[model samples]
Target chain A: MEKTIGNKTVNVSEDGYLIDLNEWDKDVATAIAQEEGITLADDHWKVIEYLQNQHKNDVPLTIRSVGKSGVVDIKGFYALFPEGPLKKASRISGIPKPVSCI
Target chain B: MTKNIVILGAGTAGTMMSNHLRRALDKDWKITIIDQRTEHHYQPGYLFVPFGVYGPEDIVKPIEKFIPDGVNLKLGAIDKIYPEKDKVVMVSGEEFDYDILIVATGTDIAPEETEGMMGPHWQKDVFDFYTLEGSSALAKKFRDWEGGKLVINIVEMPIKCPVAPLEFAFLANAFFEQKGMRDKVDIVFATPMSGAFTKPKATEKLDYLLNEKNIEIVPDFNVMAVDGEAKTIMDYGGKEVSYDVLVTVPTNKGSDLMERSRIGDELNYIPTDRATLQTKVKENIFAIGDATNIPASKAGSVAHFEGEVLLENVLNYIQGKDLKEGFDGHANCFIETGHGKALLIDFNYTHEPVSGTFPFPGVGPLNLLKESRMNHMGKMAFKWIYWNMLITGRHLPFVTTKMQEAGKNFD
Candidate 1:
């Protein structure tokens, strides 16, 4: 399924996770953040930036790696993304769902 | 006339009962088991998944492999049950009449029952290690993850494997130490109980372990909500626990089929007579394992013990004899304390886990309420025992279904 996020038409799974990574942009991130009941703060942006950078560099984004990234501490990462930090951060950053998640 | 024995579910209790009944009953009795899925999971192994002790493939096998030749295995969802008529209806519109019915469909983690539990963060930062998929997902999450405040919380009690969360904390401590970053991880154990565990004797030993490991124990915490945005879990009393990553043992409930069949409690667990393992709902119906509302630990060991009691009582009921009120709520648990050491606790309805040796009075190789390498080996050996001896209805030489007080230390 596809939904219009801001000005971009991005593909999403039935569960509302982003399906197409290529279709994601800054506007899409803002839209996802809005849906998740979060306003993108600087700390949130740092996680999204780190996640997008890791995806671009072909690095696997895990909670441990994210904690070790030095961009934010593990607790800070949770505060930034709230409910599911890794999932929401990745979604807002416009990446395909992580393989390890259910 | 052929008498039919219909067993619902093909899990540990159901599978073991099926095997036992097939051997004990004569050829005139036709045995049939109904399950929605074909694969059976070693649920206890799920606790080891996040720590990478066991993989998904190592714990799962075909249900048909354990089932005997004479038993009929039916694959279909349960639609409804008519206890009054001694019949069961499947979702596919198939029906089966039974002279005796045993319900052992078991319980599952219901994450959605908690508010904000299955939100966007689900499978991301907040995860459970109870199910095969959940544990596998957590295994990936734990890999290369520098830890922060790792909160292991139980939403409520009476869950399967009561000792598992404590085991997880111990294993995670070991896991991080192996990664050489044990100092970086702050582990917190938040529970609804007043202490580290339910039984007093076991609680004292476990509390010391937690204190020695520098892991915080937040007891009597009734979780009300998970504020994903704030990254904190709020309790009923307005206390909050923040987490870097949250590992939860969600609320466990009986199979949905139980409620549809009008044979279960509010939680869908069937009402069963404590001693006999027979359903209080009907004379011909019986319930066992995690599916029943018995005051027993919902562990595989308890199920195995119940299987022993059930086999005898079910047979007696079939022959119109007095049912044996022999089940003693026997449960044995192994607490994995990491570093190649573990603890074993054996208890039943009346007794709490105490300090001493197990099975053998003065010559036991296993220690109770104390950490030992022997206990660890015994814990690891149980997987093989479960597949080979326990489910096959083979009697274990040393242990009995009833709790023996000879070896246990009360003073």
Candidate 2:
């Protein structure tokens, strides 16, 4: 499915994660973050950049890893994204949601 | 010159690979599997231990029982792997060189990662069911449990058998019902996931099950610490959920060997090619199951599914052929919805679990994503299959390494 975020249209999943990261940009991220009641600040972008960088390297994301990434602590991560930090960060970063399906 | 195919961990994935490759490799090519643990446990049975559906005797067996005759089973702690040197160093000061290395070093619960988890009430009111000792201890604790607020909390994601906690909640409901104390117990399932199940359609169905069983779902709760003295789990967001007895699935990580070797990720899981099961560490090195940072579920079934792809990849690596991107992350699991019923979910990397017929297209032996007695039977029957067929590297009849989408209702 395609969703219009800010001035750009991008593919998204039913859960609203960006289907293709190539279509992601700052405007799109701000638009997605806006839906979650989060305004992208410098710290949020740092987390988003960290998440995108991790996704690029194929390292599976987790709150524990994000906390240990030296980008932010767990409490700081929650404070940045509020609730569901990993999912929110992934969404704004335009990466697949980090999940364990067993 | 004699060559070696060294395997780490004699658990499900390692043992199965050892059996699968031993007969195929030439006599000159030696296969040695190493693990510190002596017993091979049927890990799925751990979910039933706390409920007494299965006993300690049922799930455990000697590791030596599964190793094929030609393969050598080295029982010792592996200190590190020098991938560049093609060597494995044991903690006891012994070293073994290998032509190829297979790391099936499965994950384990790290309760100490969470503050106060291993504190004063370690195995008393606060318990973990991932380990044999944990499950057995939990069973003993449940013997005279009068039932109050029983919270089953998962501290983090990527835990082994992702659905086991939900199964625990469902079984707890059934357990209390059988004891004629269902109403006396308030069941709470606290997880980091957004819902009872991760998949959408499955969540829709499972959410109904949770409601029907009266199990409370507490989503988006990431544990910062276990307040053992207060009997509460404190999330990073400052959400506190109190419990009379808490069964938590703590942070799970790859083998310590990976940590010692400095070849693993932050969680000590080896970064691997998701499709090929080949590790990023080295060309000759491959990782499978819970040990690798594959997005797939860290369950025996995932390892079982990956075995076919990984086996082919190893053979390919030996033959100097290009590796096939054959693995599709196929995972099949039975969700115990309690009342002697369960839901069987069959899915892959690209597909979510949908309602359909399994093994057979339209003919009805087992149903997917729908609760049935047959699915529960399939789950129970899996134990025998695990012991007899799975560990022996034989394929189950009608099941394929890749998921069959013919009978499934997609959309």
Candidate 3:
């Protein structure tokens, strides 16, 4: 299935993940974590929510501010989502309009 | 029939190659250059545009003005390269046959490749100095701006003129100091690399300069996305850095034609023999400048040196002789550290940047790995050399194609 994040359309495997209560459930989280190589934490959920909401609201995020926010370390975040959130989260969230991430 | 030589993308490498080859080839040999634009930019001047040191009028000139007479300059977008046939097809459906092809089609910024980089805040709070337009726009923004938090970020590696963002940060410090706004602004440098530079010695020097300038160094910070509304840059680690003004060095990639041709590596850079400058896909085709996937610094000096070696090989190829592997991957760059002082570094693939006397060993002139006023003057004087000599295929008096070991302190 595909969903829209920011201006991008991302594909989610039908068997992979499911969104639950503003957070990705265990199965979906595990799939996202394995796929993105990130250890998703509760604070990271806040980041995910913020990114998703920013996409929905058309707000943009800077990498510097993201690093300073202290939700996660810069290296850890890069390891989990090497391609960055707009690409990875959009795919996991099943967002449409993938080019919007650009 | 005269042999046809087609050069794609009339940038630094393309222009230099055309000038070099035109002098070597007889009148009977046809040399055609294909490019999309009529204006040729002195790319290094883009860094100064944001600081008002170089105006738009200074950087651009007509492509025809620089290209020699008798060489056909075709202004059009290249569609694809048919290496199997030794031809380049243009977007306008015109195909030109060539005996040999030179791919000098340099790189482009893919700000769009990064999420939210080209979004609402683009050119407003988030600016890139890599482009002529972006740099000029930033100058205006810098002029009227009361600084809060100015963050200089490099999104990825392999960007053109790797020291440019650092130069911008340094220049920004000088700019703010001149304007008496240095106390008002907090400058931070965020890079994807483990340190300030790719080389360890250069990194040590740059780290010291960063600390000296009070520019906080946040290394290994991989950019995730930009929250323009929130004014924050988030890393995957959930670390966020907030900025009042975001100066970003976006991701750079080779020409889209590489993607269309399906012959490039992961980043769309053509794989080539590092020493030969010959494309791995075809013997008749060669890659130069920022286009090749060579593990060397992508500076104008690298192209200038590569041009020398490649030209020799090209002539050898025409005579049906074995091409010599002469390119040493030599690159020399002037690092501007603000305050009317700069550092010079000369190195190749194997050697890290070292400190010693340059050109003349232990005698006089430019000092390597040390900031000096003379190096800064040399850096400033290079613009005249570039336009009058370098691009015209004239050999620089003090500079050579190969790196000399005599002047460097290896120990």
Which model scores highest in DockQ?
2
Selected candidate, larger lDDT, 1 vs 3: 1
Return whichever of 2 and 3 wins on TM-score: 2
lDDT of 3 by residue, B45-84 (tens): 9999888899988899998888988789999988998888
Q: B-chain TM-score, every candidate? A: 0.99, 0.99, 0.98
Interface RMSD against the true structure, candidate 1 = 13.4
Clashing pairs in 1: A64-B145, A64-B146, A82-B228, A84-B121
DockQ of 1: 0.01
Best by lDDT: 2
lDDT of 2 by residue, B267-314 (tens): 889999999999999999999889999888888888998999998999
Arrange candidates by lDDT, highest first: which order?
Answer: 2, 1, 3
Candidate 3 to truth, TM: 0.81
DockQ ranking of the models: 2, 3, 1
Report the lDDT tens digits of candidate 3 across residue range A1-102: 665333434444453333333444445544656556666667556666655565575433434334445665555545545645434655454332222111
The Cα local distance difference test for each model comes to 0.86, 0.90, 0.81
The regions of model 3 sitting more than 4 angstroms off are A1-102
Give each model's clash number: 4, 0, 47
Question: Model 1 chain B, poorest ten-residue lDDT window?
Answer: B220-229
